[model samples]
Target: MMLREVNTQGETKSGEMIAEMIIECIKEAGHENVVQVVTDNASNCVKACALISAKFPTILWTPCVVHTLNLALKNICAPVHNPRSNEDVYDACYWIKSISEDVTWIKNFIMNHGMRLVMFT
Candidate 1:
């Protein structure tokens, strides 16, 4: 079910504020029906979950799976360094980064050149 959509223009996006917003939503939606709350793995969001857990002991707070997977992929694909030398080390997911860069370059190339874009279309 859709909950409140905060403006957050002049207000702070702190953990306390986020927790309060979540609690308000749960209360409005009938807390008894709420089994879990899911959010991204941001530090503030994690802290908000902790606060929410304290308020409603029965409710479980979980991180979004897609965000978690994106974090995992980012960590895995990030370039590493050898302890001995300045050489760069890459993992199996490195190819994904390469392909992404190539695609970006191709997109830019096509966008910048009107003739290439016309022919491709």
Candidate 2:
């Protein structure tokens, strides 16, 4: 269950607030029923996990695997390196770029054609 809906009008979310919110949710859901907490790999979220671990040592806090996988893919697709000379540096994986472009083109093609989109769906 969602504990709170963060809004743009309020103060920026802090580690403490996030921890408290998670604790509240765990309590509401029955602490015994919750084996672990999965959260995104944001710095605030990681800090919140630390806070949670400090308060409840038995409960495990883990980063979302999907987020971790996406980060890995992003790093592999777009690598950063220092260029030795004054030239453009494109270190992205060619195969990954080609696949991504093909997927994008397919999506655009399907979206542009009503019948093709219906058939694809």
Local distance difference test, per candidate? 0.79, 0.75
Quick one: best TM-score, which candidate?
1
Candidate 1 on 1-121: residue-level lDDT in tens?
6565667998778999999999999999888999999999999999999999999999999899978976655554554533332224354456777665676688789789879646543
How displaced is residue 79 in candidate 2, in Å? 2.8
lDDT of 1 at 66: 74
**Which residue runs does candidate 2 get wrong by more than 4 Å?**
1-10, 80-93, 98-121
How much does each candidate deviate from the true structure in C-alpha RMSD? 8.5, 7.0
Top candidate on lDDT is 1
